[model samples]
Target: MGLILTEDQLILRDMAKSFFDEKSPVERMRALRDSRDAVGFSRDLWKEMGELGWIGILFPESVGGADMGYGELGVVLGECGRVLAPEPFMSTVLLGGNAILLGGNEPLQKELLPDVCSGNRILSLAFQERGRFAPYAIETKAKRDGDHYTITGRKSFVLDGHVADQIVVAARTAGSSGEREGLSLFVVEADAPGLTIHRDDLVDGRNGAHLVLENVAVDGARVLGTVDAGADVLDAVFNRATVGLCAEMVGSFEEAFERTLEYLKTREQFGVKIGTFQALRHRIANLFAEMEFTRSIVRDAQTAIDEGRNDIAEATSAAKARCSEVAPLIAGEAVQMHGGIGMTDEEEIGLFFKRLKAAELSLGDAIFHRNRFAHLRGY
Candidate 1:
C-alpha cells in the first residue's frame, strides 16, 4: 500500500507548523507557562487557529464544522505536539467535540458547535472520576425528574474542565439491565447552579479539575444520544481521543529526538562532541529509529480511523501503548544527555521532558492501553 500523505494534508501540516513558529515561539510558551493561569492557552492564538479552520477540522460541515477527516486533523495535532502550543485542542476539539458530533442531536450541535468552532467557548468531557479512568465505571448518577434530570456526581482529572463553558458528563441513568443499559451522557452549563469546580495543579502546569455536581439540574433536552445507550458514545469519543493522543506522541517523540540529537552535536565532553562517542551515538540512533516506527504506526491508526475500520480500536491501543512506553524513554534520555543543564528550568529540554512524561501518562498509559489491546484482541 502506498503510504503517501495527500498533497493537501501535507500542505495543511506545513501551514500549521509555520503558523506556530511565527506566532507561538518558545518565548510565548514560557511566558504562558509562568502566568498565574497556566491553562497555558493564548486566546488570540486560539482565535487565529480557529480562523484557520483547525478547531473544527474534523467536524461535519453541516453544523459549521469543516467535515475534514482525522488524517488531516492528526496533522494539525502533530504540529502542536512538535511546538508545544499550549491550547486545549485535544481535550476540547478532539475529545469533547467528538462526543457532541457523534451523540448530540442536530439542535444541540447547532446550539454548541458554533461557539466551539469559533473558539468563543471551550467544552470538556467530564467522565473520569477520582482514581477511576474507565469510563464505564461511572460513579456519577442522574435521576429522572418529570421533564428534566437532576445530576449529582464528582468527576476528576478533566482536561480543561475548570475553564470550560460546558461539560458533557457521563453518569448512570439506569441499572445494569443485563443489556448494557447503565450509562448516559448529559450536557450541562459550566456555571449551572449547584455545580462546583475544583482546579488541580498538574505536573505540566496544565488545567484540570475535580467537579462536584450537587443537585445540578438541567433540562431533559441536554441528554445526548439515545438515553440508556451512551456506551457507544463513550466508545467513539474515547477511541478517537486515544488515537489522537497517539498522533501527538509521534510528534513529541520526533521533536524530543531531534532536540537531544542537537544537544549531542554541540555539548562537548572530553574535548569532543558527545555525539561522536559510539555508545551515545548508538542510543540516539536507536531513538531516532523508534520515532520513525512510531510515526508509521500512528499514521496507520489514523488512516484506519478515517476509514471507519474496526481494526482502529485495537491498532490504536497498540500504537498508544508503544508510544507511551517509548516517549518517556526518549524524553528521559534526552534529559540525561544534557547532563546538569537538562534538569534545570533554564533549559527548554526539561520542559519537553516534562510534557512528554505528562503525555505518556494521560488518556491511557502503556499499561492501560495494553489492557485495552488485549480486550480488543479477544473480540
Candidate 2:
C-alpha cells in the first residue's frame, strides 16, 4: 500500500515537529532527567499540547477531539520521537486513553474523556506481571464482593504509574493463569487505598513504577467493558499501542540515522571525512535500507489499523518485531561509526542509543514478537 500522507496529515506532522522543536527539545529531556521531575514530564507542556488538540488525536468528535485516525496520531508520535521529547503521550494518550475508549461504557467515556483530552487527567496501563508480555499470563486477581471487588496482586513496569490520575489494570476474574478466558480490566484511582507505587528511573530518561495492590477495593462502576469478557478489549488496546510504539521507533531510527550521517560528513578521520570511507558508506547504506524497510512496515501497520483490517494483530506484531530488530542495529552502527565520542554522555547519539534500547524491550522485544507472529499464524 502507498504510505503517502494526506494534506491534513502533512500539516499535522509539521505542526507536531515544530511544536516539539520549540517547546520540548533534547535539552528539556536532559533537564527533566537531571532534576528527577516527580511527574517525569512537563505538565505545562502537556497542557499546552492538549490546548493545541494533540492529546485528542484519536478520540471521537463528541469527546472534544479532532476526529482524526491513528495514522495522524502516528505522524505526531513519530515527530515526538525524533527529538526524544519526554512526555507520557504514549502511556497517557495511546495506552491509557485508548483503553477507556475501547472498553469504557458511554457514561464512563462522558465522565473521563473530556478531562483526558484537556490534559486535566493522566492515565496509564498496569498489565504486566513478573515481566511477562503474554496478555493471558495474568496473575492479578480481582475477587468480587457485594457491588465491589478486592484486587490483590503486583504489577511491574507500569508505564507512568507513579503519576497517573488513573490506571487501567488487568486481572483474572474467572480463569486460571495463562488462560484467555475470564480476564477483565478495571480503572483504579492512582491513590486508592491499599495501592503502593514504587518509581524507578529508567536508562532512557523516563520513569515507570511497580504497583502492589493489597486488597484494593474498586467499585463495580470501575469495571471496563463486560465483567469477565475483557480479553478482546485488552487485546485491541495492546495491538494498537504496539503499533503506536513502532511509529515512535521509526522516528527514533530516522533521527539517529540522520544524526549519524551528519556526523560522518563532518567528523574527520585520516585528514578526510569518515563518510567518504567505502566501508562506512556501505554500513550507512545498509542502515538506510533497514530504516526504509521498518518505515514501510510501520506505515502498513498503522494503515491497517486505520482501515480496520482483520489482520491488524499480525501486521502490528510484524511491524513491532521488525522495528525491535532494526532499532538496536541502527543504534549500534551509529555509535560505532561515531567512534569514541559516541560512548560519552556528552554526545547526543548515546541518548538515542539508550532510547532505542528501551523501545526494543518496551512492549515486546524482537524475539517475543517473532514468536507471537508465528503463533498468530498457528506455527
Candidate 3:
C-alpha cells in the first residue's frame, strides 16, 4: 500500500485546502462558539459543500454520491481539521450515513441518502450512552409491538444531535448492555414525539447533544440491519470514523507544530530569537518527527480502508493509538513553547490544543486503542 498521495489525491487536497481556507476559517468556529449558534454550523455553507460534491464522497452514484473511497474523504477531513471547521462530516457522513449505506435496505438508502448527499438532511448516531466510548454498552431498549417499536433510554455525546434531521438510534432488542449480540439500529426523526434533545457546548468549542427518548415509536422499516445484529454495522462505522478522526488529528497537530515553529523563529527571548536556543530547537525537532510519523500512520490507515484490506481493524487501531499518543504530546509541547500566549483563547494555537485533546478522546484514547491493537493481533 502507498503512503504517499497520488497526483489526483494531491489535487483534491489542494482544492479542499483552498475551499476551507476561503469559506470556513478558524474565525467561523470561534464565531459559532461565541454566539452559541443554534445550528452550530451554517447550512448554507453545508449546501455549498454539497454542491461541490464534498458531502457525497462516500456514497454510491445511485444515491447522488460520487462513489469514492475513504482516501478522498480523508483528504477533505484533514483540510477541515486544519481550519477546525465545525461541519458534520463525522456525525453525518461517517457515522449515520455509513450505517444506512452499509446496513440499510435499498429503499431506506434511496429515501435518506439522497438528502444526505445534497446536504438537505443532517444525520447523527446515538450510540454512546455512557461516559466512555464503549460501542456495545447501550442501555436503550426498543420493544417491538407488531409493526412499530417503542424506544426508551438516554444518549450522551450524540455529535450534532441537536441539528440532525434523523438519528440512527442503537437500542438493545434482545441481549443486555455490554453484550455484542441483540443490538439493533433504528432511524428516528429528530422531531419525533417523546424525544428530548439537550444541546451541549463541548470543551473543544464543538456541539454535542444529549437525547432522552421516552417511549419513542419507530416503524419496523427504519431498522438499518437485522433485528439482533447491529454490532456489525457499528463496527464498520466506527472503523471508518476512527480512521477519519485520525486523519483530522494529523492535520491539527501538523498545523499546531508549524504555528509553534513559526513563533519560535519570530518570538524574541533575551533579545534574540527563541529558535536559536539549542534546547528549544531539539524539542521542536522531536515534535516534527512525531508529527511526520503520525501523518504516515494515518495515511496508511486511510489507504487500508480504500484498498479494502482484511486487516483494517489492525491498521485503524494502530493509527488511532499513534494519533492518540502524538496529538496530545504535540499540542502540549506547542502550548508550552508558546508560553503565556498559548494559554489564552485569543491565540489560534490554543484552539488547536483543545481540538487535538478532544480528538484524542473521541473514538478511543491511546491506552484503549493499544489494548484493542493487542487483542486484534491475537496477543
Candidate 4:
C-alpha cells in the first residue's frame, strides 16, 4: 500500500528504514537469542535511537519531543518490524510512555517525559492479569494510605517488566474486577521493596515478566490522573498502542509476503520455478491483497489518532482486528510456501512468523478487537 506521504514523512520513513537495517537487523535478534541476552535488547542501540529523536516523535515539543504525530511514529515502528528489531520501543514508547503522557499530571509529565524521551529510563505497563487482554479486568488493589498508596496484585505478561525502571500499574481502588469505574493507574518503581519481577522469554525472542506487587508503596504524587478514573486513560493508551501494533504487524506481514515471493521465484520444483505455478501465483496474489488492505486500515487508524477524531476507538479496533486476523495468515502461508526450511530456527521466515504471532496476541487478538469494535459501534 503506497501511502501519500509528505516530504517529512517520507524522509522519516527512509531514515528509520536505513537505521534499523544497519543497526538492528533480524540477524541481531538471532544473535541475541543465541547468546541468551538477559536484557533482550541493546541499551546502546536504544540510546542511539533516542539520539536520533525516534522515541520523541509522538510527543509534544514541550516534553522534549519532536511534536510529531502517531503517523510518523507508525512509520518508524513499521521499519522496526521489517527487521524484527528487538528493542523496547513498543513497550516503552507506545504503552508506558503513552500512559504517562495521557494520564499523568503536568508535573509528573515534566519529570518523566524527558527521561523517557532521552532513553535514560525504561518503563512498562503492568495491567494484564490472568493472561487476559481486557484492560478493565484488573484484579490488583491499590489501597489509599494517608499520603501514599499500597498496591498488592500480580500482573501477568507485562511487556518490559523485567528491565523497566518504572512500571505503570492498573489497580482497583474501589470497583470490582471487570468494572471500569474504580480502576486507577500508579507509577511503581521496579525496585520497590515488596515488588517481584519474574522474567520470562517469550517465543518471539523477546523478554516479558510477571509482576507481583505485595504491598508495594507508592507516593500519592505517583498516581496517574484521578484515583478512580483510570479506565478512560487505559482506553486511550490501549487504542493508541493497538494502532502502533497494527502498524508493526503490517510491516511484518508485508516482509513475510515479500520473502515468500522471492523464494517462489527462485525455488524450483519439477524443473520450473514455483512462481510459475498458477496455484502459487493465485495464493500470492491473495496474500498481497490482504497485506495492502491491512496497511490501509493501519494508515487510517494512525490518522484518526493524529487528528483526535471522534471515531478513533472504532478505527483503532478495526485496524487492530484486521491486522491480527491477516498477520498470522500471511505468516503461516509464507512458511507453508517455503516448505520445511521456513520452520527451522536458522530460517529468517521462522523469526518473522514468531514475531507476527506475538503481535497477533499482544494487546488483543482478532476476536477480542472484533468484539470491542462491535460494542463500540452500539451493536
Candidate 5:
C-alpha cells in the first residue's frame, strides 16, 4: 500500500486547503462561538460544501455521493481542521452517515442519505453515554413491542444532537452494559415524542447535546442491520471515525506548528530573532519529525480502511495513539514558544491549543488506544 498521496489526491488536498483558507478561516469558528448560534454551524456554508460534492465524498454514486475512499475524505477533514471549521462532518458524515451506509437497509439508505449528501438534513450518533470513550458500554435499553421498539435511556456528548434530523442510537436489547452482544442500532427522529434534547456548548466552540429518551418509540423498520448484531456495525463506524479524527488532529497540530514557526522567524527576542536560538531550533526539529511521522501513520490507517486490510484495526489504533500523543506535545510547544500571547484568548494559537487538546481526547485517548493496540497484538 502506498503511504503517499497520489497525484489526484495531492490536487484534491491543495484544492481543499485553498478552499478552507478562503471560506472557513479560524475567525469563523470564533464568531460562531461568540454569537452562541443555535445551530452551531452555518447551514448555508454546509450546503455550499455539499454543492462542492464534499459532504458526499464517501457514499456510493447512486446516492448522490462522489463514491470516493477515506483518503479523499481525510484530505477534506485535514483542511477543515486547519481552519477549525465548525461544520458537522464528524457527526453527520463519519459517525452517523457511515452507520447507515454500513448497516442500514436499502430503503433507509435511500430515505436519508440523499438528503445528507445535499446538506438538507443533519445526522448524529447518540452512542456515547459516559464521560469517556467506550463503544460497547451502552446501557440505553430498547425494548421491543409488536412492531416497534421503546427506547429508554440517556446519551451524553451527542455531537450536534440538538439539530440532527435523524439520530442513529445504540441501545441494548439483551446483554448488559459492557457486553458486545445483544446491542442494536436504530434511527430515531429528532422530534420523536418522549425525546428531550439539551444543547451543550463545547469548550472548542463546537456543539454537543444530551438526550433523554423516555419511552421514545421507533418503528422496527428503522433498525439498521440485524436485531441483535449491531456491534459489528458500531465497531466498523468507530474505527472509521477514529481514523478520521486522527486525520483532523494531524491538520490541527500541523497548523499550530507552522504558525509557531512563523512566530519564531518574525518575533524578536533580545534584539535578535528567536529562530537563531539553538535550543528552540532543536525543539522545532523534534516537533517537525513527530508531525511527519503522525502524517504517515494516519495515511496508512486511511489506506487500510480503503483497502479493506485485515490489519485495519491495528493501523487505526496506532494512528490514533500516535496522534493523541503528538498533538498535545505540539500544541503545548506552540503555546510555550508563543510565550504570553498564546495564553490569551485573542491569540490564534490558543484556539489551536484548545482544539488539539479536545482532539487528543476524542475517539480514544492515548492510553486507551495503547491498551487496545496491545490487546489486538496478543500482548
Candidate 6:
C-alpha cells in the first residue's frame, strides 16, 4: 500500500533523502567507526539542513521551526535512517529540542532553540540510568540549594552525549513511593563544573555517553518544567521520540528489504536466479506483507500523535513493538538470503544489517514496547 504522505511531507522526505544520499554514505559512516567520539555527519551538510529549517520541522514557525507535524518529521526521519545519518536527529531535534517546546521557560527557549535550529549547537537527553527503559526509575538526584540545584548521580546511554552543547536531564526529587511526584527535568550545560562525560559507542556505531554528576550545580534558570512536576512533560518528549524512532526503523527495514530483493534478482543458484525460486519468493512476499503492516502501524501512530489523540501511548507502543520485531526479522532474512556475502563489512547490505540490529533496541526495544502495549490495554 502507498503511504499517506501529503505533498509537503513528500517534499520533506525527498529533501532528507537527497541530503542523506549525498552526505552520509555507508563509507562515510564506516570511516568514523574508529574515531573515539561522535559519528556525526559533515558540518557543511548539517548547516544545509539548518538552512532548510528541517531541524525544527515540528516546532512552531514563530520559534524558527517549519511547524510541520510528525507526518513530515517521520518521513524525514525515515530518510535519515536510510543512510544512518549520525547527526543526532532524534537526540537533538526530537528529544532535547522537544522538551523546550513542551515545557521550557520562554527565556530558555529564546536563548537555546535558535542556535539549536541553526545546527550551531548540539544537544541530547540525559534521562536514563542503568535501567533506561524505566522512565520513573531514576536514582539521579537534583536537590534545590540556595539559588540553584545540585545534581548527584549517573545517567547512562545518553545519545550524542559527549558532543552535546547541552543535556536535558531527568532527576528525582522525591521518594519512589510517589514516583511521578517530586521528579523533574533540567537543562544542564555540557561543561558544567561538576559534570564528567564518558563516551561509549553503541552497537549502531553511534557515540553514546554516560554522564556522571558529582554535585553538578545548576542555576535556577536551568530548570525545564515546574519543580517536581516533570513526569508528564518527559512523557511527551519520549512519545515524540518513539514516533520518530519508528519512522527511522521503518526506513532501515525498507532499505534492507529492497536491497535483499535486488540481490535475489541477481544471484544465481543451480544456474537460476534465486528470485525465481518459489520457496524464497514466498518468503520474500511474506516479509513484504509484514513490513507493510508495520508501515501502517507507524502511519497510524504518527497520525494519532499529530492530532493530539489521547491514545498516544497505545499507538506509540504498537508502532515501536511492530518495528522492533519486524525490522530485525526482515534484516536477518535479508542477510540469510544474501548468504556469506552479506556478512562482510565491505558489502553495503551488511551495513544496513548492522544498523537494523542497532535500531532493534533503541529507545525501548521490542519487549519493552510490548509490555507497554499490554499496560496501555489495561493488562
In order, the Cα lDDT scores of the candidates are 0.82, 0.89, 0.92, 0.90, 0.94, 0.84
User: How do the predictions measure up, each by TM-score?
Assistant: 0.95, 0.97, 0.98, 0.98, 0.98, 0.95
lDDT of 6 at 372: 90
Stretches > 4 Å off in candidate 4? 1-3
Using lDDT as the measure, name the better of candidate 3 and candidate 5.
5
For candidate 3, list the clashing residue pairs, or say none. none
Better of 4 and 5 by lDDT: 5
- Weakest lDDT window of 10 consecutive positions for candidate 2: 130-139
Supply candidate 6's per-residue lDDT for 318: 96
Cα error, candidate 6, residue 347 (Å): 1.4
Better of 4 and 6 by TM-score: 4
Please write out the lDDT profile of model 4 over residues 185-268, one tens digit for every residue: 999888999999999889999888998899999999999888899989999999999998888888888889999999999998
Model 1 pairs whose backbones collide: none
- lDDT of candidate 2 over 25-101, digit per residue (tens): 88888889988888889998888888998889889879887777778889988988899987888788888899999
lDDT of 6 by residue, 55-157 (tens): 8778777778888788888887888777777777878888899888887988899888888888887889987786437778888998889999999999898
- Supply the global lDDT for candidate 3: 0.92
Model 6 misplaced regions, further than 4 Å? 1-3, 34-39
As a TM-score, model 2 comes out at 0.97
Model 3: per-residue Cα lDDT over 245-318, one tens digit each: 99888878888888999999999989999999999999999988888888888888988888998989999999
Ten-residue stretch with the least lDDT total in model 4: 1-10
Which wins on lDDT, candidate 4 or candidate 6?
4
Query: Which is the leading candidate under lDDT?
Result: 5
Query: What's the residue-level lDDT of 188 in candidate 6?
Result: 93
lDDT of 1 by residue, 1-379 (tens): 2245798988998898899788877667777768756455787788778888888888877766798877888888888888777788877887788888889988999998987887888889988875525557776889999989999988888888878888898888887422347889998899999999988766765778899999899899988887889888888888788878877777776887888898899988899999899989889888888877877877888888888887978878888888898999899999899899889998887777888878887777888889989997995
Order of candidate numbers by lDDT, starting with the best: 5, 3, 4, 2, 6, 1
